[model samples]
Target: MVSISNSVKTGITTGTLRRVHHIALNVQDMQASRHFYGTILGLHELKGEEVPKTLIELVAAGKVANFVTPDGTVIDLFGEPELAPPDPDPKRGFTRANHLAFDIAPELFEQAVEVLRENQILIDHGPVTRPTGRGIYFYDPDGFMIEIRCDPMD
Candidate 1:
Protein backbone atom coordinates (compact mmCIF):
# COMPACT_ATOMS: atom_id res chain seq x y z
CA MET A 1 0.00 0.00 0.00
CA VAL A 2 1.19 3.49 -0.79
CA SER A 3 1.58 5.61 2.32
CA ILE A 4 0.04 9.09 2.28
CA SER A 5 3.45 10.59 3.00
CA ASN A 6 4.97 8.66 0.13
CA SER A 7 2.13 9.64 -2.17
CA VAL A 8 2.68 13.26 -1.17
CA LYS A 9 6.41 12.97 -1.87
CA THR A 10 5.62 11.49 -5.28
CA GLY A 11 3.14 14.27 -5.94
CA ILE A 12 0.25 11.85 -6.35
CA THR A 13 -1.83 14.39 -4.47
CA THR A 14 -1.24 17.83 -2.97
CA GLY A 15 -1.45 16.22 0.49
CA THR A 16 -3.49 19.20 1.58
CA LEU A 17 -6.88 17.50 1.43
CA ARG A 18 -8.20 17.80 4.96
CA ARG A 19 -11.61 16.18 5.12
CA VAL A 20 -14.96 15.80 3.42
CA HIS A 21 -17.10 18.92 3.82
CA HIS A 22 -20.43 17.37 2.89
CA ILE A 23 -22.36 14.99 0.64
CA ALA A 24 -25.38 15.55 -1.57
CA LEU A 25 -28.23 13.17 -2.34
CA ASN A 26 -31.21 13.39 -4.64
CA VAL A 27 -34.56 12.72 -2.97
CA GLN A 28 -38.18 12.40 -4.00
CA ASP A 29 -39.51 14.43 -1.07
CA MET A 30 -37.54 17.07 0.76
CA GLN A 31 -39.74 17.05 3.85
CA ALA A 32 -39.43 13.30 4.37
CA SER A 33 -35.69 13.36 3.81
CA ARG A 34 -35.36 16.25 6.19
CA HIS A 35 -37.33 14.41 8.84
CA PHE A 36 -35.17 11.32 8.44
CA TYR A 37 -31.82 13.06 8.56
CA GLY A 38 -32.74 15.78 11.00
CA THR A 39 -35.22 14.02 13.29
CA ILE A 40 -34.49 10.30 13.07
CA LEU A 41 -30.74 10.55 12.59
CA GLY A 42 -30.43 13.41 15.09
CA LEU A 43 -28.17 15.53 12.94
CA HIS A 44 -28.41 19.16 13.94
CA GLU A 45 -29.06 21.41 11.02
CA LEU A 46 -26.97 24.54 10.81
CA LYS A 47 -29.08 27.60 10.18
CA GLY A 48 -26.73 29.78 8.23
CA GLU A 49 -27.58 32.52 5.75
CA GLU A 50 -31.14 32.87 4.68
CA VAL A 51 -31.86 31.39 1.30
CA PRO A 52 -33.18 33.89 -1.23
CA LYS A 53 -36.96 34.06 -1.48
CA THR A 54 -36.84 32.99 -5.10
CA LEU A 55 -34.72 29.94 -4.26
CA ILE A 56 -37.02 29.06 -1.41
CA GLU A 57 -39.92 29.30 -3.76
CA LEU A 58 -38.14 27.08 -6.21
CA VAL A 59 -37.50 24.54 -3.47
CA ALA A 60 -41.14 24.68 -2.50
CA ALA A 61 -41.89 23.94 -6.14
CA GLY A 62 -39.93 20.69 -5.86
CA LYS A 63 -36.40 21.91 -6.49
CA VAL A 64 -34.24 20.96 -3.54
CA ALA A 65 -33.52 21.29 0.16
CA ASN A 66 -30.03 21.59 1.60
CA PHE A 67 -29.16 20.66 5.17
CA VAL A 68 -26.00 20.38 7.21
CA THR A 69 -25.18 17.71 9.76
CA PRO A 70 -23.96 18.63 13.23
CA ASP A 71 -20.39 17.82 12.19
CA GLY A 72 -20.62 20.19 9.23
CA THR A 73 -21.58 17.54 6.71
CA VAL A 74 -23.94 19.09 4.23
CA ILE A 75 -26.66 16.85 2.85
CA ASP A 76 -28.28 18.17 -0.29
CA LEU A 77 -31.52 16.50 -1.26
CA PHE A 78 -32.65 17.10 -4.80
CA GLY A 79 -36.33 16.79 -5.51
CA GLU A 80 -36.92 14.42 -8.39
CA PRO A 81 -40.53 13.42 -8.24
CA GLU A 82 -40.55 11.23 -11.31
CA LEU A 83 -37.30 9.33 -11.05
CA ALA A 84 -37.48 5.84 -9.58
CA PRO A 85 -35.87 5.36 -6.19
CA PRO A 86 -32.47 3.67 -5.99
CA ASP A 87 -32.39 -0.11 -5.82
CA PRO A 88 -31.16 -1.73 -2.60
CA ASP A 89 -29.89 -4.95 -4.17
CA PRO A 90 -26.15 -4.69 -4.66
CA LYS A 91 -26.20 -7.30 -7.41
CA ARG A 92 -28.62 -5.25 -9.47
CA GLY A 93 -26.92 -3.23 -12.16
CA PHE A 94 -28.82 -0.09 -11.13
CA THR A 95 -28.11 -0.37 -7.43
CA ARG A 96 -26.00 2.43 -6.04
CA ALA A 97 -22.59 1.13 -5.01
CA ASN A 98 -21.38 4.28 -3.34
CA HIS A 99 -22.44 4.99 0.22
CA LEU A 100 -21.60 7.10 3.24
CA ALA A 101 -20.45 5.71 6.57
CA PHE A 102 -20.50 7.56 9.86
CA ASP A 103 -18.08 6.76 12.63
CA ILE A 104 -19.41 6.12 16.11
CA ALA A 105 -18.28 4.67 19.42
CA PRO A 106 -18.50 0.94 20.00
CA GLU A 107 -20.81 1.44 22.96
CA LEU A 108 -23.25 3.38 20.83
CA PHE A 109 -23.47 0.77 18.08
CA GLU A 110 -26.32 -1.10 19.78
CA GLN A 111 -28.11 2.14 20.52
CA ALA A 112 -27.84 3.11 16.88
CA VAL A 113 -29.32 -0.23 15.89
CA GLU A 114 -32.24 0.33 18.26
CA VAL A 115 -32.81 3.79 16.89
CA LEU A 116 -32.90 2.44 13.35
CA ARG A 117 -35.27 -0.31 14.40
CA GLU A 118 -37.59 2.14 16.16
CA ASN A 119 -37.68 4.24 13.03
CA GLN A 120 -38.64 1.17 10.96
CA ILE A 121 -35.50 1.47 8.88
CA LEU A 122 -34.49 -1.89 7.46
CA ILE A 123 -31.00 -3.13 8.14
CA ASP A 124 -29.29 -3.99 4.88
CA HIS A 125 -26.52 -5.96 6.53
CA GLY A 126 -24.86 -6.74 9.80
CA PRO A 127 -23.37 -5.22 12.83
CA VAL A 128 -20.60 -7.27 11.27
CA THR A 129 -17.01 -7.26 12.44
CA ARG A 130 -14.35 -5.71 10.25
CA PRO A 131 -10.66 -5.35 10.67
CA THR A 132 -11.23 -1.85 12.00
CA GLY A 133 -14.45 -2.40 13.97
CA ARG A 134 -18.14 -3.29 13.90
CA GLY A 135 -20.47 -1.89 11.26
CA ILE A 136 -24.11 -2.00 10.23
CA TYR A 137 -25.65 -1.13 6.87
CA PHE A 138 -29.08 0.30 6.20
CA TYR A 139 -30.92 2.30 3.60
CA ASP A 140 -32.21 5.82 3.71
CA PRO A 141 -35.68 6.81 2.55
CA ASP A 142 -34.29 7.09 -0.95
CA GLY A 143 -32.84 3.58 -0.89
CA PHE A 144 -29.37 4.99 -0.51
CA MET A 145 -27.21 2.69 1.57
CA ILE A 146 -25.81 4.15 4.77
CA GLU A 147 -23.35 2.62 7.17
CA ILE A 148 -22.73 3.19 10.86
CA ARG A 149 -19.36 1.92 11.96
CA CYS A 150 -17.92 1.75 15.44
CA ASP A 151 -14.38 2.19 14.08
CA PRO A 152 -13.07 4.29 11.23
CA MET A 153 -10.05 3.69 9.10
CA ASP A 154 -6.91 5.39 10.38
Candidate 2:
Protein backbone atom coordinates (compact mmCIF):
# COMPACT_ATOMS: atom_id res chain seq x y z
CA MET A 1 0.00 0.00 0.00
CA VAL A 2 1.22 3.46 -0.82
CA SER A 3 1.51 5.97 2.06
CA ILE A 4 -1.60 5.36 4.19
CA SER A 5 -1.04 8.65 6.08
CA ASN A 6 -0.88 10.63 2.82
CA SER A 7 -4.13 9.04 1.60
CA VAL A 8 -5.86 9.86 4.91
CA LYS A 9 -4.72 13.46 4.73
CA THR A 10 -6.05 13.76 1.17
CA GLY A 11 -9.41 12.38 2.26
CA ILE A 12 -9.76 14.83 5.16
CA THR A 13 -11.26 18.22 4.41
CA THR A 14 -11.95 21.38 6.39
CA GLY A 15 -15.45 22.03 7.76
CA THR A 16 -17.19 24.55 10.00
CA LEU A 17 -19.43 23.78 12.98
CA ARG A 18 -22.92 25.14 12.33
CA ARG A 19 -25.00 25.29 15.47
CA VAL A 20 -26.41 23.40 18.44
CA HIS A 21 -28.20 20.14 17.77
CA HIS A 22 -30.16 20.04 21.00
CA ILE A 23 -30.36 21.10 24.64
CA ALA A 24 -30.74 18.45 27.31
CA LEU A 25 -32.57 19.36 30.48
CA ASN A 26 -33.61 17.35 33.54
CA VAL A 27 -37.24 18.03 34.38
CA GLN A 28 -39.34 17.05 37.35
CA ASP A 29 -42.39 15.72 35.49
CA MET A 30 -41.87 14.61 31.94
CA GLN A 31 -45.51 14.93 30.93
CA ALA A 32 -45.97 18.30 32.58
CA SER A 33 -42.76 19.61 31.13
CA ARG A 34 -43.79 18.31 27.76
CA HIS A 35 -47.17 20.03 28.01
CA PHE A 36 -45.60 23.28 29.12
CA TYR A 37 -43.06 23.26 26.34
CA GLY A 38 -45.14 21.57 23.69
CA THR A 39 -48.54 23.12 24.35
CA ILE A 40 -47.77 26.46 25.93
CA LEU A 41 -44.45 27.29 24.33
CA GLY A 42 -45.55 25.64 21.05
CA LEU A 43 -42.50 23.41 20.62
CA HIS A 44 -43.51 20.61 18.29
CA GLU A 45 -43.47 17.06 19.58
CA LEU A 46 -41.62 14.23 17.88
CA LYS A 47 -42.42 10.51 18.23
CA GLY A 48 -42.71 10.69 22.03
CA GLU A 49 -40.41 7.73 22.47
CA GLU A 50 -39.37 6.45 25.89
CA VAL A 51 -35.83 5.06 25.93
CA PRO A 52 -35.27 4.37 29.62
CA LYS A 53 -32.23 6.53 30.53
CA THR A 54 -31.65 8.27 27.26
CA LEU A 55 -32.82 11.86 26.80
CA ILE A 56 -36.03 12.72 24.96
CA GLU A 57 -36.08 15.26 22.14
CA LEU A 58 -38.90 17.78 21.56
CA VAL A 59 -38.21 19.65 18.35
CA ALA A 60 -38.79 23.37 18.54
CA ALA A 61 -41.52 24.09 16.00
CA GLY A 62 -40.83 20.66 14.45
CA LYS A 63 -39.35 19.89 11.05
CA VAL A 64 -40.92 22.87 9.30
CA ALA A 65 -39.09 25.18 11.69
CA ASN A 66 -35.79 24.81 9.87
CA PHE A 67 -36.12 28.35 8.46
CA VAL A 68 -36.16 29.89 11.95
CA THR A 69 -32.38 29.78 12.37
CA PRO A 70 -29.51 30.21 9.97
CA ASP A 71 -27.80 26.95 10.96
CA GLY A 72 -31.10 25.06 11.26
CA THR A 73 -30.53 23.98 14.85
CA VAL A 74 -33.53 22.55 16.64
CA ILE A 75 -34.24 22.92 20.34
CA ASP A 76 -34.53 19.60 22.16
CA LEU A 77 -36.36 19.31 25.44
CA PHE A 78 -35.21 16.54 27.80
CA GLY A 79 -36.81 14.84 30.73
CA GLU A 80 -34.96 13.35 33.69
CA PRO A 81 -36.64 11.59 36.59
CA GLU A 82 -34.24 13.02 39.15
CA LEU A 83 -34.14 16.61 37.86
CA ALA A 84 -36.18 18.45 40.44
CA PRO A 85 -36.15 22.19 41.13
CA PRO A 86 -33.89 23.44 43.89
CA ASP A 87 -35.45 24.61 47.13
CA PRO A 88 -35.82 28.37 47.36
CA ASP A 89 -34.25 30.39 50.13
CA PRO A 90 -36.99 32.84 51.13
CA LYS A 91 -34.44 35.38 52.33
CA ARG A 92 -32.35 35.16 49.19
CA GLY A 93 -35.29 35.35 46.76
CA PHE A 94 -35.43 33.27 43.62
CA THR A 95 -31.97 33.38 42.12
CA ARG A 96 -30.06 30.95 39.92
CA ALA A 97 -28.05 30.63 36.75
CA ASN A 98 -30.56 28.19 35.22
CA HIS A 99 -33.31 29.74 33.15
CA LEU A 100 -34.86 29.79 29.67
CA ALA A 101 -36.17 32.79 27.75
CA PHE A 102 -38.51 33.36 24.82
CA ASP A 103 -39.35 36.48 22.89
CA ILE A 104 -43.02 37.38 22.62
CA ALA A 105 -44.82 39.70 20.24
CA PRO A 106 -44.65 43.24 21.63
CA GLU A 107 -48.45 43.64 21.73
CA LEU A 108 -49.15 40.14 23.08
CA PHE A 109 -47.25 40.56 26.34
CA GLU A 110 -50.35 40.86 28.53
CA GLN A 111 -52.06 37.99 26.80
CA ALA A 112 -49.04 35.81 27.50
CA VAL A 113 -49.12 36.63 31.20
CA GLU A 114 -52.84 35.90 31.34
CA VAL A 115 -52.26 32.53 29.78
CA LEU A 116 -49.62 31.69 32.41
CA ARG A 117 -51.86 32.90 35.22
CA GLU A 118 -54.75 30.82 33.90
CA ASN A 119 -52.50 27.79 34.03
CA GLN A 120 -51.94 28.63 37.71
CA ILE A 121 -48.25 29.18 37.09
CA LEU A 122 -46.78 31.71 39.49
CA ILE A 123 -45.91 35.10 37.96
CA ASP A 124 -42.53 36.06 39.43
CA HIS A 125 -42.48 39.56 37.96
CA GLY A 126 -44.11 41.96 35.53
CA PRO A 127 -44.76 42.17 31.84
CA VAL A 128 -43.95 45.78 32.49
CA THR A 129 -42.15 47.90 29.95
CA ARG A 130 -38.40 48.23 29.93
CA PRO A 131 -36.29 50.22 27.52
CA THR A 132 -36.54 47.46 24.98
CA GLY A 133 -40.07 46.07 25.35
CA ARG A 134 -42.46 44.41 27.79
CA GLY A 135 -41.09 41.49 29.81
CA ILE A 136 -42.28 39.07 32.45
CA TYR A 137 -40.67 36.32 34.55
CA PHE A 138 -42.26 33.17 35.85
CA TYR A 139 -41.36 29.75 37.19
CA ASP A 140 -42.14 26.37 35.80
CA PRO A 141 -43.23 23.46 37.97
CA ASP A 142 -39.55 22.71 38.52
CA GLY A 143 -38.81 26.22 39.81
CA PHE A 144 -36.85 27.07 36.70
CA MET A 145 -37.59 30.68 35.82
CA ILE A 146 -38.80 31.27 32.30
CA GLU A 147 -38.68 34.77 30.85
CA ILE A 148 -41.09 35.80 28.13
CA ARG A 149 -40.58 39.20 26.54
CA CYS A 150 -40.39 41.27 23.41
CA ASP A 151 -37.32 43.15 22.22
CA PRO A 152 -34.91 42.18 25.02
CA MET A 153 -32.21 44.77 25.73
CA ASP A 154 -28.54 43.93 25.63
Candidate 3:
Protein backbone atom coordinates (compact mmCIF):
# COMPACT_ATOMS: atom_id res chain seq x y z
CA MET A 1 0.00 0.00 0.00
CA VAL A 2 1.15 3.54 -0.79
CA SER A 3 0.76 6.35 1.71
CA ILE A 4 0.46 10.03 0.80
CA SER A 5 1.76 12.72 3.17
CA ASN A 6 -0.63 15.48 4.27
CA SER A 7 1.11 18.05 2.10
CA VAL A 8 0.83 15.91 -1.01
CA LYS A 9 -2.75 14.95 -0.20
CA THR A 10 -3.67 18.60 0.08
CA GLY A 11 -1.90 19.46 -3.18
CA ILE A 12 0.45 21.85 -1.45
CA THR A 13 3.68 22.29 -3.40
CA THR A 14 6.36 24.95 -3.08
CA GLY A 15 6.79 27.36 -6.03
CA THR A 16 3.88 25.86 -7.86
CA LEU A 17 1.86 29.06 -8.03
CA ARG A 18 3.22 32.48 -8.96
CA ARG A 19 1.93 36.01 -8.42
CA VAL A 20 -0.77 37.74 -10.45
CA HIS A 21 0.48 38.80 -13.89
CA HIS A 22 -2.14 41.36 -14.91
CA ILE A 23 -5.57 42.85 -14.60
CA ALA A 24 -7.72 44.20 -17.47
CA LEU A 25 -10.14 47.08 -17.24
CA ASN A 26 -12.60 48.54 -19.74
CA VAL A 27 -12.54 52.33 -20.00
CA GLN A 28 -14.34 55.08 -21.88
CA ASP A 29 -11.38 57.25 -22.87
CA MET A 30 -8.05 55.62 -23.70
CA GLN A 31 -5.98 58.79 -23.44
CA ALA A 32 -7.44 59.93 -20.10
CA SER A 33 -7.18 56.48 -18.62
CA ARG A 34 -3.65 56.18 -19.93
CA HIS A 35 -2.60 59.44 -18.31
CA PHE A 36 -4.14 58.51 -14.97
CA TYR A 37 -2.58 55.06 -14.81
CA GLY A 38 0.68 55.60 -16.64
CA THR A 39 1.57 59.18 -15.76
CA ILE A 40 -0.05 59.83 -12.40
CA LEU A 41 0.38 56.34 -10.95
CA GLY A 42 3.91 56.07 -12.37
CA LEU A 43 3.38 52.84 -14.21
CA HIS A 44 5.36 52.41 -17.43
CA GLU A 45 3.59 52.03 -20.73
CA LEU A 46 4.69 48.95 -22.60
CA LYS A 47 2.94 49.37 -25.95
CA GLY A 48 -0.29 50.32 -27.67
CA GLU A 49 -2.29 48.28 -30.10
CA GLU A 50 -5.76 47.71 -31.45
CA VAL A 51 -7.88 45.15 -29.67
CA PRO A 52 -8.56 41.93 -31.56
CA LYS A 53 -11.22 42.25 -34.22
CA THR A 54 -13.48 39.72 -32.52
CA LEU A 55 -13.25 41.56 -29.19
CA ILE A 56 -13.84 44.94 -30.81
CA GLU A 57 -16.90 43.67 -32.61
CA LEU A 58 -18.25 41.93 -29.54
CA VAL A 59 -17.36 44.32 -26.73
CA ALA A 60 -17.08 47.50 -28.81
CA ALA A 61 -13.57 48.29 -27.58
CA GLY A 62 -11.43 49.36 -30.51
CA LYS A 63 -8.06 49.93 -28.90
CA VAL A 64 -6.02 48.67 -25.96
CA ALA A 65 -2.95 49.80 -24.07
CA ASN A 66 -0.70 48.01 -21.60
CA PHE A 67 1.23 49.27 -18.62
CA VAL A 68 3.42 47.74 -15.95
CA THR A 69 3.92 48.66 -12.34
CA PRO A 70 7.34 48.80 -10.66
CA ASP A 71 6.61 45.36 -9.18
CA GLY A 72 5.78 43.92 -12.61
CA THR A 73 2.03 43.91 -12.30
CA VAL A 74 0.39 44.52 -15.66
CA ILE A 75 -2.65 46.67 -16.32
CA ASP A 76 -4.49 46.41 -19.63
CA LEU A 77 -6.82 49.25 -20.51
CA PHE A 78 -9.52 48.89 -23.13
CA GLY A 79 -11.36 51.75 -24.82
CA GLU A 80 -14.65 51.62 -26.66
CA PRO A 81 -16.13 54.34 -28.84
CA GLU A 82 -19.86 55.17 -29.24
CA LEU A 83 -20.82 53.16 -26.18
CA ALA A 84 -22.42 55.18 -23.43
CA PRO A 85 -21.24 54.51 -19.90
CA PRO A 86 -23.73 52.45 -17.95
CA ASP A 87 -26.08 54.15 -15.57
CA PRO A 88 -25.16 53.79 -11.91
CA ASP A 89 -26.95 51.20 -9.83
CA PRO A 90 -29.23 52.89 -7.36
CA LYS A 91 -28.19 50.55 -4.58
CA ARG A 92 -24.48 51.02 -5.15
CA GLY A 93 -24.66 54.76 -5.88
CA PHE A 94 -22.58 56.63 -8.49
CA THR A 95 -18.98 55.45 -8.04
CA ARG A 96 -17.54 51.98 -8.34
CA ALA A 97 -18.79 49.48 -5.81
CA ASN A 98 -15.62 47.38 -6.02
CA HIS A 99 -11.95 48.23 -6.24
CA LEU A 100 -8.45 47.04 -7.05
CA ALA A 101 -5.94 47.25 -4.22
CA PHE A 102 -2.16 47.55 -4.47
CA ASP A 103 0.27 46.69 -1.72
CA ILE A 104 2.74 49.36 -0.63
CA ALA A 105 5.48 49.65 1.94
CA PRO A 106 4.56 51.22 5.25
CA GLU A 107 7.09 54.01 4.77
CA LEU A 108 5.75 54.88 1.34
CA PHE A 109 2.10 55.05 2.31
CA GLU A 110 2.24 58.70 3.45
CA GLN A 111 4.21 59.75 0.41
CA ALA A 112 1.67 58.03 -1.80
CA VAL A 113 -1.14 59.93 -0.13
CA GLU A 114 0.71 63.21 -0.66
CA VAL A 115 1.23 62.40 -4.30
CA LEU A 116 -2.49 61.87 -4.82
CA ARG A 117 -3.28 65.09 -3.01
CA GLU A 118 -0.82 67.03 -5.11
CA ASN A 119 -2.42 65.63 -8.23
CA GLN A 120 -5.83 66.85 -7.05
CA ILE A 121 -7.22 63.35 -6.71
CA LEU A 122 -10.01 63.03 -4.22
CA ILE A 123 -9.86 60.29 -1.59
CA ASP A 124 -13.10 58.34 -1.49
CA HIS A 125 -12.37 56.77 1.86
CA GLY A 126 -9.73 55.78 4.35
CA PRO A 127 -6.18 56.16 5.66
CA VAL A 128 -7.88 53.88 8.12
CA THR A 129 -5.93 51.37 10.19
CA ARG A 130 -6.92 47.80 10.80
CA PRO A 131 -5.32 44.86 12.55
CA THR A 132 -3.69 43.76 9.33
CA GLY A 133 -2.73 47.14 7.84
CA ARG A 134 -3.47 50.74 6.95
CA GLY A 135 -5.29 51.68 3.74
CA ILE A 136 -6.75 54.51 1.70
CA TYR A 137 -9.21 54.54 -1.17
CA PHE A 138 -9.68 56.79 -4.19
CA TYR A 139 -11.36 56.84 -7.57
CA ASP A 140 -9.66 56.48 -10.93
CA PRO A 141 -10.50 58.55 -14.00
CA ASP A 142 -13.20 56.12 -15.04
CA GLY A 143 -14.84 56.06 -11.61
CA PHE A 144 -13.28 52.79 -10.59
CA MET A 145 -12.20 52.65 -6.96
CA ILE A 146 -8.58 51.95 -6.10
CA GLU A 147 -6.82 51.27 -2.84
CA ILE A 148 -3.24 51.50 -1.62
CA ARG A 149 -2.48 49.67 1.57
CA CYS A 150 0.51 48.79 3.73
CA ASP A 151 1.20 46.21 6.36
CA PRO A 152 3.75 46.89 9.09
CA MET A 153 5.63 43.60 8.75
CA ASP A 154 5.39 43.41 4.99
Candidate 4:
Protein backbone atom coordinates (compact mmCIF):
# COMPACT_ATOMS: atom_id res chain seq x y z
CA MET A 1 0.00 0.00 0.00
CA VAL A 2 1.19 3.52 -0.72
CA SER A 3 1.26 5.39 2.55
CA ILE A 4 -0.14 8.91 2.63
CA SER A 5 1.74 11.41 4.73
CA ASN A 6 0.06 12.36 8.04
CA SER A 7 -0.04 15.94 6.84
CA VAL A 8 -2.15 15.02 3.84
CA LYS A 9 -4.55 12.92 5.88
CA THR A 10 -5.34 15.68 8.40
CA GLY A 11 -4.65 18.79 6.36
CA ILE A 12 -7.19 21.38 5.17
CA THR A 13 -7.58 19.54 1.86
CA THR A 14 -8.36 16.19 3.48
CA GLY A 15 -12.13 16.39 3.37
CA THR A 16 -12.35 18.93 0.54
CA LEU A 17 -12.06 16.15 -1.97
CA ARG A 18 -15.31 14.27 -1.93
CA ARG A 19 -15.96 10.78 -3.25
CA VAL A 20 -14.31 9.57 -6.43
CA HIS A 21 -15.75 11.11 -9.54
CA HIS A 22 -14.28 8.51 -11.88
CA ILE A 23 -11.36 6.33 -12.70
CA ALA A 24 -9.84 6.05 -16.16
CA LEU A 25 -8.20 2.92 -17.52
CA ASN A 26 -6.57 1.98 -20.79
CA VAL A 27 -8.02 -0.99 -22.64
CA GLN A 28 -6.98 -3.11 -25.59
CA ASP A 29 -10.41 -3.17 -27.23
CA MET A 30 -13.28 -0.91 -26.35
CA GLN A 31 -15.93 -3.36 -27.53
CA ALA A 32 -14.61 -6.28 -25.46
CA SER A 33 -14.21 -4.04 -22.47
CA ARG A 34 -17.73 -2.79 -22.94
CA HIS A 35 -19.05 -6.33 -22.94
CA PHE A 36 -17.08 -7.18 -19.83
CA TYR A 37 -18.12 -4.09 -17.94
CA GLY A 38 -21.57 -3.48 -19.38
CA THR A 39 -23.12 -6.69 -20.68
CA ILE A 40 -21.53 -9.08 -18.20
CA LEU A 41 -21.05 -6.92 -15.17
CA GLY A 42 -24.23 -5.01 -16.01
CA LEU A 43 -22.95 -1.51 -15.43
CA HIS A 44 -25.23 1.17 -16.84
CA GLU A 45 -23.49 3.58 -19.20
CA LEU A 46 -23.74 7.27 -19.84
CA LYS A 47 -24.85 8.08 -23.36
CA GLY A 48 -23.32 10.60 -25.76
CA GLU A 49 -25.38 13.50 -24.47
CA GLU A 50 -23.86 13.14 -21.03
CA VAL A 51 -20.25 12.98 -22.11
CA PRO A 52 -18.08 15.72 -23.58
CA LYS A 53 -18.47 16.46 -27.30
CA THR A 54 -14.84 15.65 -27.98
CA LEU A 55 -15.38 12.13 -26.65
CA ILE A 56 -18.28 11.44 -29.03
CA GLU A 57 -15.96 10.50 -31.88
CA LEU A 58 -13.92 8.19 -29.72
CA VAL A 59 -17.05 6.54 -28.35
CA ALA A 60 -18.40 5.80 -31.82
CA ALA A 61 -15.06 4.42 -32.92
CA GLY A 62 -15.14 2.04 -29.94
CA LYS A 63 -12.14 3.80 -28.42
CA VAL A 64 -13.80 5.28 -25.35
CA ALA A 65 -16.62 4.60 -22.88
CA ASN A 66 -17.99 5.64 -19.49
CA PHE A 67 -19.82 3.23 -17.24
CA VAL A 68 -21.51 4.22 -14.01
CA THR A 69 -21.10 2.09 -10.89
CA PRO A 70 -23.72 1.48 -8.25
CA ASP A 71 -22.23 4.19 -6.06
CA GLY A 72 -22.44 6.72 -8.91
CA THR A 73 -18.75 6.69 -9.62
CA VAL A 74 -17.72 6.34 -13.25
CA ILE A 75 -15.25 4.00 -14.87
CA ASP A 76 -13.89 5.52 -18.05
CA LEU A 77 -12.21 3.36 -20.64
CA PHE A 78 -9.99 4.43 -23.51
CA GLY A 79 -8.24 2.37 -26.17
CA GLU A 80 -4.49 2.31 -25.92
CA PRO A 81 -2.57 2.14 -29.16
CA GLU A 82 0.34 0.60 -27.32
CA LEU A 83 -0.30 -1.17 -24.06
CA ALA A 84 2.41 -2.25 -21.72
CA PRO A 85 2.68 -5.89 -20.75
CA PRO A 86 1.64 -6.92 -17.24
CA ASP A 87 4.34 -7.51 -14.71
CA PRO A 88 4.96 -11.24 -14.23
CA ASP A 89 5.76 -10.73 -10.58
CA PRO A 90 4.02 -8.15 -8.46
CA LYS A 91 4.35 -7.59 -4.74
CA ARG A 92 1.28 -8.66 -2.81
CA GLY A 93 -1.50 -6.04 -2.62
CA PHE A 94 0.11 -4.01 -5.39
CA THR A 95 -2.07 -3.44 -8.45
CA ARG A 96 0.14 -0.97 -10.32
CA ALA A 97 -2.91 1.15 -11.22
CA ASN A 98 -4.79 -1.55 -13.15
CA HIS A 99 -7.00 -2.94 -10.44
CA LEU A 100 -10.49 -2.11 -9.20
CA ALA A 101 -12.68 -3.32 -6.35
CA PHE A 102 -16.26 -2.90 -5.13
CA ASP A 103 -18.41 -4.41 -2.45
CA ILE A 104 -21.62 -6.32 -3.04
CA ALA A 105 -24.36 -7.56 -0.75
CA PRO A 106 -22.84 -10.31 1.36
CA GLU A 107 -25.60 -12.79 0.60
CA LEU A 108 -24.88 -12.46 -3.14
CA PHE A 109 -21.20 -13.33 -3.07
CA GLU A 110 -21.60 -16.94 -4.09
CA GLN A 111 -24.02 -16.11 -6.88
CA ALA A 112 -21.64 -13.55 -8.29
CA VAL A 113 -18.85 -16.12 -8.13
CA GLU A 114 -21.04 -18.57 -9.98
CA VAL A 115 -21.77 -16.01 -12.68
CA LEU A 116 -18.08 -15.41 -13.28
CA ARG A 117 -17.45 -19.14 -13.53
CA GLU A 118 -20.38 -19.63 -15.92
CA ASN A 119 -19.00 -16.88 -18.14
CA GLN A 120 -15.59 -18.57 -18.25
CA ILE A 121 -13.87 -15.60 -16.61
CA LEU A 122 -10.72 -16.87 -14.93
CA ILE A 123 -10.54 -16.40 -11.19
CA ASP A 124 -7.16 -14.97 -10.37
CA HIS A 125 -7.20 -14.84 -6.59
CA GLY A 126 -10.20 -16.00 -4.59
CA PRO A 127 -13.73 -16.43 -3.54
CA VAL A 128 -12.07 -16.66 -0.18
CA THR A 129 -12.57 -15.17 3.25
CA ARG A 130 -11.26 -11.72 3.97
CA PRO A 131 -11.35 -9.77 7.19
CA THR A 132 -14.11 -7.67 5.69
CA GLY A 133 -16.09 -10.59 4.29
CA ARG A 134 -16.04 -12.94 1.28
CA GLY A 135 -14.30 -11.82 -1.91
CA ILE A 136 -13.43 -12.88 -5.41
CA TYR A 137 -10.87 -11.63 -7.91
CA PHE A 138 -10.65 -11.88 -11.66
CA TYR A 139 -9.12 -10.14 -14.64
CA ASP A 140 -10.79 -8.09 -17.32
CA PRO A 141 -10.22 -8.43 -21.05
CA ASP A 142 -7.29 -6.05 -20.88
CA GLY A 143 -5.78 -7.91 -17.91
CA PHE A 144 -6.92 -5.34 -15.39
CA MET A 145 -7.78 -7.16 -12.20
CA ILE A 146 -11.20 -6.57 -10.59
CA GLU A 147 -12.58 -7.56 -7.22
CA ILE A 148 -16.17 -7.93 -6.09
CA ARG A 149 -16.65 -8.51 -2.39
CA CYS A 150 -18.84 -7.97 0.61
CA ASP A 151 -18.86 -4.92 2.85
CA PRO A 152 -17.31 -4.90 6.28
CA MET A 153 -20.72 -5.15 7.89
CA ASP A 154 -20.87 -8.73 6.75
Q: Write the per-residue lDDT of candidate 2 for residues 69-100, one digit (tens) a residue.
A: 12333444455666534555322234445466
Off by over 4 Å in 4: 1-12, 84-95, 152-154
**Once superposed on the true structure, which residue ranges of model 2 sit more than 4 Å away at CA?**
1-20, 48-73, 88-98, 152-154
- Candidate 3, residues 1-154: lDDT per residue as tens digits? 7897777556658887798777888777888888888877887877434333434443344377777777887788878655344654322435444788888899999999988899987688888899899999887777788899999655
Q: How does each model score on TM-score?
A: 0.73, 0.61, 0.70, 0.80
Expressed as tens digits, the lDDT of each residue in 39-92 for candidate 4 is 878898879698768778888877889899989998999888576556533323
Worst 10 residues of 3 by lDDT: 88-97
Q: Which prediction has more favorable TM-score, 1 or 3?
A: 1
Q: Is candidate 2 or candidate 4 better by lDDT?
A: 4
User: By lDDT, who's the top model here?
Assistant: 4
In angstroms, the error of model 3 at 9 is 15
Which sections of candidate 1 miss by over 4 Å? 1-12, 48-62, 86-96, 152-154
C-alpha positional error of residue 61 in candidate 4 after TM-score superposition, expressed in Å: 3.1
Instruction: Provide the clash count, candidate 4.
Output: 0
At residue 7, candidate 1 shows an lDDT of: 40
Q: lDDT by residue for model 1 over 1-154, one digit each (tens)?
A: 7455644545447667877765767776667877888887777544435433535765556576666655666676777776664554542424435678887878788899899999898678887987889988887777777888887434
User: What does the lDDT read for residue 94 in candidate 4?
Assistant: 36
Instruction: Identify the leading candidate in terms of TM-score.
Output: 4
Error of 1 at 61 (Å): 5.2
Q: Per-model C-alpha lDDT, please?
A: 0.72, 0.58, 0.75, 0.80
Question: Model 1: clashing residue pairs?
Answer: none
